[model samples]
Target: MARLRRFLDRIEPQFQKGGPYEKYFALYEMVDTFIYSPADVTRGSPHVRDAIDLKRVMSYVVVATFPVLLLMLWNTGFQANNAISQMGMTGLDGWRNWVMSTLGIAHDPNSVFANMFYGLLYFLPMYITTLVAGGIFEVIFAAVRNHEVNEGFLVSSMLYTLTLPPSTPLWMVALGIIFGVVLGKEVFGGTGKNFLNPALTGRAFLYFAYPAAMSGDAVWTAVDGYTGATPLALAASGGIDAVKEAGYSWSQTFLGVMPGSLGETSTLAILIGAAFLIYTRVANFRIILGVFLGMVATSLLFNLIGSDTNPMFSVPWYWHLTMGGLAFGMVFMATDPVSAAMTNKGRWIYGALIGFMAVMIRVVNPAFPEGIMLAILFGNIFAPLIDYFVVQANIKRRMKRS
Candidate 1:
């Protein structure tokens, strides 16, 4: 560690102002701070201090995502392996198959190692594409603007990758992330200045623009031609009965053994990540609680007004909690520090809005079955206003007291 620090100190001058590599200072600082805390620190009085910094906060979030990432790999592989076996295909036809064969790993859904490795083949490509494509833009913007590269994108890229279906094309992955970083965030002045979540922005773009690849049954399972409706989709079509008839139980979806996006399928895994984030204070509990309560309230209301025509109207609140991306979005997306409500009271309102909108969209809209992504994005748009009103209300109360 000492040797590395010394090495960095020695080379720091080369990347300083007026140096030959000055233009690349942002890249250098990114690597340096990523490995070690910044060398600069406040030395004056009246200073506020805390152990947690931006890099540490972002790092904790990445760590918290491990549970979801693990499930994403296992569930994705399990679904693909199960699909291939059901179809009785001899073998997959691509580099993935070649690698699996070379590694002597079988396409057995029951084999944990097989499932994990197979899923890794799919996840790695998408993740790499997101990181590289989004990273290039982050660097370009930082260099052009003469600012230090922020670590926010680390979380953004990971969340974006998790939001995607396993079979999403590499080209689309690159394009989505590029659009997200450029338009969703950079155009609004990047990171903290952006009102909308960059990840969801990119996802929404893909959802609307390239609907064929982003949604529908064929995209969930990694198999070439397999078509399996997500539990939410099944519920939307024929209600709980259709979901059960399709061999999807609430337990299966909750445990994340269903066909859906890589990370959104598993409520259990998302909860685990949520717990870690809450414990670390990386995520706000108020937002999570508000979202849960709002979802329950809305879902129960729908249940009371049961629609004979739409089965989704009958889905219980608990089921809604475990369905689609609700759990994932509630835990991670809605609690985004920059994009979520800043005031304590406003956080609840923002969260409730998301939860309410998510259920409303899922039940009322025939076009989109999963609604959390859109709901969070919608909440992001109104977060500032929610905070503003909260602040104004507090000011009025204080003024009245005075």
Candidate 2:
């Protein structure tokens, strides 16, 4: 450690202003600050600060996201193996399988290790693709704009990787992240100034642009020719019994034994991550509580309205939580500090509106099975407005009282 500090100190001057390496200082500083906190101090007055900086916040969120990431690795492999086994493939199938097959590892659906290994093969490539693409864009923007490369992309890239379908092609992965980082965040003046969650924004673009690849049961399961409707898709067609008929109990769904997005299938895993965030104060409980409250009230209202036509009308709040991307979005995406409402009152309202709209869209419209993506984006758009109203209301009441 002492040697590292001395080494950095020795060469650090080269990257300083007017030095030989000053042009690449942003890149050098990114690595240097990552290893140790910057020695630069407050240069002027009005320097309000908190113990938590952007890096700390990003690190906490990334830590909270790991449970889901671990589970996604297992689940992605499990789904692929299950589908392959159903089609009677005892051997490796994909490019990953073929590569690992040489190493004496067969694609055995029953083997936990095999499933996890296969899942890793899929997850690692996509993750690398996202990191590389996003990093390039981040560095380019930082260099041109003359700012330090923000660590926010670490969180964004990971979040984006987890949300994707396992069957997504490498090209699409690169393209989606390019769109996400540049348009979603950079266009609005980079990370802190962005109005949208960059990961979801990129995903939404892929979803609308490449509907064939993004939607339906074909993409959900990795093995070709294996068709399986997700729990939400089943409920939309024939209500809760259909989900049971498909052999998924609430317990299975909660524990993440369903086919869907890589990380979003497991409610329990998502909650575990959520608990970490809440405990660490990386996420706000008031917003989470409001989302659940809105989900409960809206689902109950739909139950009374009782659609004789749509089976989704009978889907309860509990089901809503475990099914689809609701749990994942509520925990990670909804709590994004930059896009979410800032004020206490606005947080509650913003969260509630997201929850309510998610359920409303899921039940009322069968076109979109999962509404969390759109709901959070919608909430992001309205968050500033919600905060403004809350702030204005407080100002008015205080002025009147005075």
Candidate 3:
């Protein structure tokens, strides 16, 4: 264990206490790096060793994801129950009745049970497959390079699954995981070296590879004929339709009654996760606040200007926070430290630009109603550039001061 501790100290920087914080506001940053420092895993040798390992890092991710996991269970059950009811497959007359009653299905008490069971049955296999496949690739590469298996997969696996609509095929899930693991992370030398979030990279691959299957339209409640519409998509299509005043309130959106990616529908749940992350100091709160404010500002600005007189343009800026995958992506994806801008100043730029892009894509692009996915990925691509300019500006300022 001592040896392992020393090893970790060599690689990870958190173990080395830089200095004392002068202000209380900086305490969060200090604690964030402090608790994790000893376990941060040193990169170099010639140090004390301990048992601290990557498994612990992975465990933290699993813990952070519990809120989303529980919510997925409930949401999936709700959608599937609704689907079964529409199919008339409510009771033991079940199979026979299912065959007989084609369209007018009644709600069955057992529907939720069956839906929950099937949802888990399907989702677990996909999860396991992704982990196994990605683990195999990661281990092989790690072995070849003579490095420990990076715990980065922990975040990537969960994030990849979360981004997927509940209705995604198991096979597609496997394929997407492979693509994300191999090409997204491995090809770029794994984890810290990757330019984009591997999970988002996999999601993007699946988006272009199979548009029909990954779309907001495809994210449904799963009742035989009960069609599911993403709130964002619906709002986009309704654009000032008389229904806007009568139905679809932003409150519902905030509460997550709307259809979307499985774990993304509940802003309340995501907020819980966010709070935990912030409290635990696993995430940088500054970036979170900056991105959120930026998103709200940009979205409101677009609403003021009115994008194309479409009914979607009428959606209040705050609605963007709850709609689609905005909440989930911002809280989780955009904050990844490695792919996000490194410097504090760069993070503000990185986050603000991401928020802006997300709103622009949602409002200006007719081809896609959901923009969080694209926007976050777009931000990942630009993170380095943002950092470059930040660093250059700092150098010039220092030179002037000198």
Candidate 4:
């Protein structure tokens, strides 16, 4: 502690007199030494240290994302059961919906459990394939780089799986994760060094690679025969007229009674996960709050602008947050510390821009109803630039004051 203080004391003058800058500089120095302790072991530092580890960082992320995983299990199961009922396959020659329904607490063979279990059965293979493939890549990278396998991918894999539709093929999942791990994380120098979240990279890869599995009428539902369109897709396809006739209720949407990705359908579950994340301090509330504000504001502006073709433009700005992956993405992906803007000031802009871009892309690009994935990936790439400009602007202001 004394050594760190002495080191900071030496460099403090270069930053400024006693102020937040000095304080932040000191904090950065402390974290730099502590977080970068591995470098000290190799580089022979002044031998100052503190208590912190990669496990602690990764634990926070796991803890934060736990709610999301639980919600995914329930929602996926629920959707699968509902789809089965619609297809009248709840009772088959060699049916298993009875057991599924009993366990998940949904009575009708076509109830929540039937759906949840069906979706889970289908999605689990894809999820496992992705993790295994991505894990192999991670291990190879770690072996070649001679660094410990970082904890970053643990949460990334989970997030990636959660974002996927239950029906995505296992092979496609494996390929996507491979692309994500190799291109997104490994190529960028592994783990914390990556610019974009690796999981999103995987999702993006699959989206581009297998647009059929990634989207369209079949991917959202668990049933073999029935055509299940995602709420966003339904809205996009038929606009307000299609959705109004379908009578997509708010309750159904909140309870995950809709066709969509594994975890994104349940606003209720996502909110629960959001609360858990915020409570654990794994995510920044300010960034989340600011991003919500930006999304709401931007959505309102677009809604007010009055699109002539899409009467659903009047579907209330609040719905944007609940629909699609906006809730999950904001709570988990956009707030990733490594990829996010470093400066506090930059976070506001970074988050806001992500929110804006997400909504804009979703509305403007009919082909893609879920835009948060690409938007956050874009934000991650531009984070450093945002921070750089923010710092440069601060420097200029300080110099001008002088």
TM-score of each: 0.89, 0.88, 0.80, 0.81
Candidate 3 segments whose C-alpha is farther than 4 A from its true place: 1-57, 90-118, 223-225, 240-247
Candidate 4 is scored at a TM of: 0.81
Clashes of 3: 25
Clashes of 1: 0
Q: Model 2: how large is the Cα RMSD against the reference?
A: 5.6
Local accuracy by lDDT, each model = 0.90, 0.87, 0.71, 0.73
| Most accurate candidate by lDDT | 1
lDDT of 3 by residue, 51-115 (tens): 33444444565677888877676566666665565565545333423533454433343555544
Give the local distance difference test score of model 3. 0.71
* Candidate 1 lDDT tens digits, 1-402: 999999999999999999999999999998888667676622221101223467757888898899999999999999999999999999568999999999899999999999999999999999999999999999999899876787789999999999999999999999999999999988877767788889999999999999999989999999998999998888999999988999988899899999999889889989999999999788999999989999999999999999989899999998898879999999989988878898889989999999999999999998998999999989988988998899999999999999
lDDT of 1 at 245: 94
Worst 10 residues of 4 by lDDT: 42-51
lDDT of 2 by residue, 153-254 (tens): 999898898889888998999999999999999988786888899999999999999988888988888877788888999999999989999999999889
Worst 10 residues of 2 by lDDT: 41-50
Count of clashing residue pairs in every prediction: 0, 0, 25, 7
RMSD of each: 6.0, 5.6, 9.6, 10.4
**Using TM-score as the measure, which candidate wins?**
1
Ranking by TM-score: 1, 2, 4, 3
Ranking by lDDT: 1, 2, 4, 3
Q: Comparing candidate 2 with candidate 4, which one achieves the higher lDDT?
A: 2
